[model samples]
Target chain A: MSSHSLATRTEKTEPAPARTRRTRNRGWKPRLAPLSILRLLILFGFGIFCLVPLIWLLLTPTKTDAAILGDFPLSFGTFDRLAAAWQHLTAYSGGILFKWMLNSVYYSAGSLVITIVTGLLAGYAMATMRFPGRKTILTLTLLSMVMPATVTVLPLFLEINAVGLTNTAASVILPASFFPFGVYLAFVYFSTSVPKELLEAARLDGCSEFRAFISVVLPIAKPLIGLLAFFSFVANWNNYFLPYVMLSDQDAYNLPVGLGALMAGSPALHPERGGSFLPITRPEVALAGLIVVIPIALLFLIFQRYLVRGILSGSVKS
Target chain B: MTTSRRAAARSSATAWAFTAPYALLLLAFGVAPAVYAIYESFTSAKNPGSLGLDSYAMVLHDFRFWPAIGNVALFMVIWIPVMVCGTILLALLLHERVGRLSSTMRLIFFLPGAVTGSAAVLLWYFMLDPQVSPFAPALHAMGLHNSIDVFTSSHLAPIFALVAFITGVGQWIVVMFGALQGIPEELIESAKLDGAGPFGTALLIKLPLIRKYVIYMMILAFAAALQIFVEPSLFYSITQSGSAWWSLNQLGFAFAFGQGDFAQAATVSVILLVLSAAAALFLVFRTDFFKTEVES
Candidate 1:
């Protein structure tokens, strides 16, 4: 339960039953016992449970619009149909989906950098320095982490509108850049990972506290910085409610809001919305949905270990 | 000592300087919104000084508010326990000695989790679509004749809860699996040596050991369920019930965007904010998060 164990992606499973250790043992490999069969069956069942829908989703764009409903759920259609889906998706509102992707990257990446910088500075200070309002700030930051996002979206909308910053990318990026979770993560990482003696050593060598943090602290804080950056990017990239409320211009939306628009605008989904004339079919929406998800899927596949580690360490204790 | 005092003052100054950015951001975005929520919740849009608790009262009496609360309440009451049990069961299965196979299963289980709130809802919508759904036959089997019938008002409670539970459980499983992996190999070995079977060992020892983590997921789950918006919004095809199927968040958002009712939105948000604060305070106190790292 220590943070060290939590950091590892795979826990080296200890050999079960000491008898299984030696190849020279006369004992045969254990038979497929009833329990083992049951376990494997259950595992297979769970596997199908989680994967089928996702596979079904990925296959959607391959089918023609009519086939999307007529074909069996798991059936595959031609690549020619997939091309059609892609073409229509790209043509929607002169390729608005691409802009949403760009905006998502823009907002999340900007927020990620800001969150990391502010979080590192604040976390390092909270953990290592004696600021006057340190305790109060720490308390509030933790409180903010748990507050449901909707609670803030209302007033944040009002505040941004008050300054006439609404409908701009900053309206989304600026609010998101203030990441309480990132700040808290940085605090925990510094507290656990960076020894106070290291900072003290720098101070004794005539280094200023701020200078030491930049010169010494940040150098060794790469793992934490990477973790915080990843978390911030994911949180902001996937953010829906903030940008949904803040941005009025469809051109400024991030992936989530835009995907919501794409889904709702589908001619098949809502005939009442008057988008039936547009080339927005069920298949096109599916393709656009895939476009929004593919990057996140790739990120999870590559850095799943860190993502899992980050979530567990932040949520649970030893 | 005088020079040291100056040095100390300067060090404190640096600390303040370091924290100032986040502190200001937190104030402007966090505390300000919350303070504004309280302010706006008491006043009407027409007049700022009307100091009547109309919004809060209206929040209570809003026909949509009560059903929205009921919808979420029903979902939480069922979904949290089912999700907890399902996640624990999966963690325990993955805990067994099935080396690479278990890891592969873990990977597969974790993939669905990467799909976030709005996307997950949309993906599931296609899966549950009557004509397109693989579950079409299953829906028919349940005496639910069509896809529309499946997403009908009476069925909204179960359908929304099912979507949340199915999609949300994977992340929690991965989290609990991490906690389960933290259990020492010797504990399971000793239980086996004592002639305890797998069930007894998992039931009596492993589950109890990870009970704190379960409760942790539960608290997080409770907070998450209370904020259910993205799924419910996607599920809100026909808003005849207006706010009936809407979670607190959907209701709040609708008030602001759909109706131009900022006061009502702020009122609901303040209520949710209070609930969130209570959960957060409980989490901080229950765990070792607040103590000095050295002590932990």
Candidate 2:
């Protein structure tokens, strides 16, 4: 099937030499196609639109606040100033920034484990097995996706506080783990791609149901796993409101929430507040933004192939 | 018969085992809190002795309520269409230019999504500032000279929409592009064989084929847009000009934290919940969102 699709793709992308000659004889001056040019121009325009802010962000951490205001927008400042900016950022409240970074990883990794395990299992079950209340569970998952996460925050806070777990990491991890979207994605992939005969063949060989799932289903779910892990990790890592509402203690704050507090406390972001003794400034804030963004960006770059392949194969198989 | 019945029971047990952990978590976190919120929304915080719709009435009467709703409505009016249409157009364009170029551009487009939540707000705060923005010259050319001109209350919706679009439209573009890639090459080739140009093929063939995914994207985008909190709240904190309750979610937060009224907060949540869920339910049933057997 994949080869068939590949052949079709190649044919569509690259027309035959005979056909090209025939078109040339027909006076079809398709060279320098206007539409392709327009497409490239639009794509590049959108590309610049997306990258300018990121480029600005990357350069911001290197400059002093004065340079940010006085110098050219895209100009580079010295590494000396970059080092000074990092120092200022790290100096904020005696290196709380590092702690927030650690907390972000801790929370995201913990929740990712649960999201994958549960989402994969449930999705597999819903796809393959005929069980009572299966439709109900699926419906509930969709309904859960419909409601915005913000609607649940205060209530989640109330429930977590009622159980005396508000400040702990579990308060954030547990709620973040309720990823209905992952389960739905898994369900779609399994139902569409995974052949029932494979599992049945394994079961006939005296493998238990769970064993067949582990051996037969999981081996082909690499793309699904990649899709789930990257998304769950990014969602958990970048999530600010839940962690902010749940964790009141500054030490327990994740990078995003920590950044918010840093902004609020900074004299630089809030010029209305005028000057203060705190060293947190635009460069420091920009560095903090980079710190929050770099890990996820690195993850995306590293996993870009898997992520795209996952998306492609997901629908291609269907 | 007995043996087959036993086998059926055993398989059911195994399936339950596989799904049990997730179901339990969903019940504990998703359903339980939602139910609790529903109960709280009906019960008054001020007069717990009486359980009724007084909180809803109080919320309805609050002067900030309508304006907050209006603000989010305006944001939605801008955000949802731009996101859905922009995603589709960009995805179509990316699909047009296949191979290494498209892949690299797709990655470039998706890069902004990584800078999300409060970090996005901070980045945009600078990005919109006329003096220091990379678009400083453009801002000056447009006759805007300072932060005040950029951050005005009148400009809040568009600014937030632009920020959301920049940070958002990428992932959806990627998703929509994937859906487009799913289109059987034969179908597109056949359409081309019939002399359909790129525009006609995209508008007529590709668009219709990916209709389900588009609807799915639109529904999710609408729900997310309705919950616009972090951007507006962060902006309000930094600017200190827009009302603290600039959006519905913030209004809910203010009701809960600012006034110590969980009932009013839950009232706001319930309103949003119903709005989004109703919209979702309508769309889901109108389309094949739940049909496991999708026709490829």
Per-residue C-alpha lDDT of model 2 across residues A1-318, encoded as one tens digit per residue: 442243245335533433553454347537537777888899999899889998999998888888899999888888998899888888889999889989999999999999999999999998889888787788888777556676688788778877899899999999999998788778877876798788889988999988888888999998788889987898899998899889989999999999998887788887666778877889889999999999898998898765555444333333
lDDT of 1 by residue, B1-296 (tens): 99999988988888888998988889988888889888888887656778878888888998888888888898888888888888999889877654667778888877776677678767777766667877678767777664555666666666666777776776887778777777777887788679776688889989998988887788877888888777667667422322423788888887888888889888898898888778878877667555443233
Supply the DockQ value of model 2.
Answer: 0.57
Quote model 2's TM-score: 0.91
Local error of candidate 2 at B235, Å? 0.3
lDDT digits (tens) for residues A241-312 of candidate 1? 889888888999988899887775555565545655777777777777787778888887888777777777
Evaluated with TM-score, which candidate comes out highest?
1
* Fnat per predicted structure, each in turn: 0.60, 0.68
Q: Which ten-residue region of model 1 chain B has the weakest summed lDDT?
A: B237-246
Q: Name every residue pair that clashes in candidate 1.
A: none
lDDT of 2 by residue, B7-29 (tens): 88988999999999999988998
- Residue runs of model 2 more than 4 Å from their true location after superposition: A1-27, A30-35, A309-318, B182-197, B293-296
lDDT of 2 at A197: 81
